[model samples]
Target: MRTDVLHAVRLARLDLTLIGRNTTVLVNVLLLPLLMAWFLTESVGDVEIAGVDGRLFVLTGMPGLIPGFAVFVNLVNSFTARREELVLKRLRGGQPSAAAVLGGSALGALALYLGQVALVAVWAGRSGGLVPANVPLLLLAAVLGVVLFCLLAAAFSGITPNAELAQVTVLPVLLVMLLGAPIAFPADTLPGVLGTVSHLLPATPLVEIMRTAFLGGDHVSGDGAALSMAGQWLTALPSFAVLLIWIAVAGVLARWLFRWEPRRG
Candidate 1:
């Protein structure tokens, strides 16, 4: 790595440490989700995910989701906040590439994601019932998903003008995922057009990837639906490929159009 890249990495580590101190990030990353899961377990008490009657599936889904959400929320918020603060301006003036700055910010969130993963694993193991499956694919899908969303968030932030608008800027993407019910329902059962559209969202494939890994036979993925619902097995691959395409296109757009300047300029 270049000296600048190394410096950026160091900066990212420091920031991540500071984030551990920041209550806002701490609450969002750790407290809220844990509380949600505890309450969910109390309310539902041994509910199922796609027929998997175990806490393992629930834990797997929860941990698998953290990175995607963290990448989406953290990278964009941090990037835009720094941009509005002229941190990007100072760094660029000192010769750091946009890539370095972005990577630096992402490193912190990635670290947090990994930490969350470990905690979730411990929690799930202690909870008993169900077991995590296809560990390799689960890990791969998570890393890829994080990479994809971090860039998407940055791309969204690149076009945003100020901190106040960061949440608004991210709202559309969040709302689409929300509307599609990435967390609540199976995407396979969505209306045709809606399902097709969900195919384009970053979280869609990641969730399916998880469903396939953890839920296994119980998994009702769009990929699987293409085979049974439409009698075409090949549709799954293409649909999955679209996510990679989104990653590429969004990454390039983020690199090309992400701005560091205040909008009033």
Candidate 2:
């Protein structure tokens, strides 16, 4: 047990070092998201919807946007790079379990994602946007977002043929989360059909749940009023359920299709 833990830690450290040394990856993983959040919030400055402040809405959505990109998009590329280079195969021959090896490699990206979550909380709290009315719920939503997307990254990474193709393959899901989800625009701003489609994506519920924690309210109506459709505990249930269903399906696909080695050309 001790040995396994140590091995995982070492692998995590190795990932951290390698990731840290790469300036472009660091910018994309960390700086780009921060810039995106800053631009959107500034552009949409000091508005409100359904009695929930628009600034708060934007802040609440950051966890979904920032971490989704970092964990899912960034790690997909990282995992594919490692696999194409035979790093995963080599690691499998040694002490760490497959889970440990992947977990360790992911530690850096995970930390970055969690750090962004904390940044969102702190920035919102300090800026007087919204402090989470339910801190635990906020944290749960954030953590779940990271986990779901991380699982997705793993699943997608394995099937990606090489580092270059990872960029292309990651686009569909990334687009879903970025453009379709509430990250770029509010759920209410989207047309009904588009909103429903966005709701089906994993990011939609997580953002809604996080917003619920901050706003301390349920569904926001089109006219900027908070509706009573869901109470505190039940606020994010529908979205959560959708995410869970996706998670289950993605997990199955990942398990079935995930490859430790590059496919033969």
Candidate 3:
């Protein structure tokens, strides 16, 4: 058990080093999200949904965006690049267990994930009026979202033919979560059917969790009408269950589909 932890840590360090040296990956993982957040802030400026200011809404949903770009995109690209370079294939012949290898590979992104969370939290607190009403639930949602997205990233990487094509394949999922879900837009503003479908997305529940945490159920119409769709669904546990289901599904798919060797052209 101790050996496994050590191996995973060592591999995680190596992965972090590689990420530091790779400017493109580093920027995409760290900078892109910040840019997106900034853009959202600029564009949405002061528009309120229900009663929540647009910037605060953006801050609340930033956690969901972090995982997609930081964990999903980074890991999919990392795993596919390693496979193409035969790094994962070579590691298999060595002493490290698969769990350690994969876990280690994910450690860097996890760090970035946490960093993004902290960044959002601090920024929201000072700049956007975020005060968590349920810290435990907020943390749970953030942590689970990171883990779920990382697993999904690995699963997607398994089927990705090469690193170059990863960008194309990854965009759809990212777009759906970022644009189609509540991450980029307020859930109440979406059409009923669109909002319902968006709620089914992985990022939606996490965003809902954060929204509830920050707004403390205050983001409603001043006259006590027009509550957010997320606020309405906050009473249900289905969102958490859906996230768990997706994690399990991703794990199974990754186990079955993840390749140690590169696919033939």
Candidate 4:
């Protein structure tokens, strides 16, 4: 919050340049959405999932996916790697508080997410796609999702011994998205257990947020009206809360757990 602290975060974020970072950012922001949308736009063409036309189901699944890719790929990995390298350690030991280091990383990720969203919206609109029904809610979901993932990513990095393993730390989250969630199939077609499980995952609400936005519906993906409302709030609030908690927990853990110079053992 202080001027000096803000300056430090800015400096730290600026130093996060890597070759694969560029490629990962590009693919997440550009190619993933296009490929998903294209799959939706095209016919199912004999494809069938959960007894429904595969393409239709996949289309319904695409909106939610935007959030998942945004979090795990766009924010989570980079934040963790930054922390794993003791970037946070160095910053905290210096003039910057832990907050500043995390804040700067968050701002960087948000900038990327917004930029990518803008590009997607512009290109999709010019191509005749529909805008989301509720812009405010969708944006809220996107931002909240980023905030949660950022802290969780940073916290998880504490368990990582080196920067190279940050990818492994974040890998399971990505795997969950690819496996049981909407990204895997149309919401309607997922079996009872998978549907139930997907609804429970952290990424579920994020995908639901995008799905509701694009499909022009509420994030109420269930039978109970109250339940749907609860689900929506559950996804957003907890997703955001867990991350801040993780930040606190991780900040403390890093005091002991994080090693600046690699251990020889």
lDDT of 4 at 203: 60
lDDT of 3 by residue, 84-203 (tens): 999999987788888888878666667778778778888888996666556666677777887788788888998899999999989999888877767646565678888678767887
lDDT of 4 by residue, 1-265 (tens): 5776666567546734542367766676457766766765574555764433444435544545554555445544555555556665676788766566666766666665665566656544555464545566568766766666665555555566665676677678777766766654544456888767776666666666654554453334422122243444453454345434544664565455544333345
Q: Alpha-carbon error at 185 in model 3, in Å?
A: 3.6
Whole-model alpha-carbon lDDT for candidate 4 = 0.56
Better of 1 and 3 by TM-score: 3
- Candidate 2 or 3, higher TM-score? 2
Q: What C-alpha lDDT values do all the predictions have? A: 0.64, 0.74, 0.76, 0.56
Runs in model 3 lying further than 4 Å from the true structure: 218-236
C-alpha positional error of residue 91 in candidate 4 after TM-score superposition, expressed in Å: 1.6
N/CA/C clash count, model 1: 0
lDDT of 4 at 40: 57
Which consecutive 10 residues in model 2 have the weakest lDDT in total?
220-229
lDDT of 2 by residue, 140-211 (tens): 776677767777888988788899998898888877777887764557677779877877778877877777
Rank the models by lDDT, top first: 3, 2, 1, 4
After TM-score superposition, the amount by which residue 96's alpha carbon in candidate 3 deviates from its true location, in angstroms, is: 1.8
What RMSD value applies to candidate 1?
Answer: 4.5
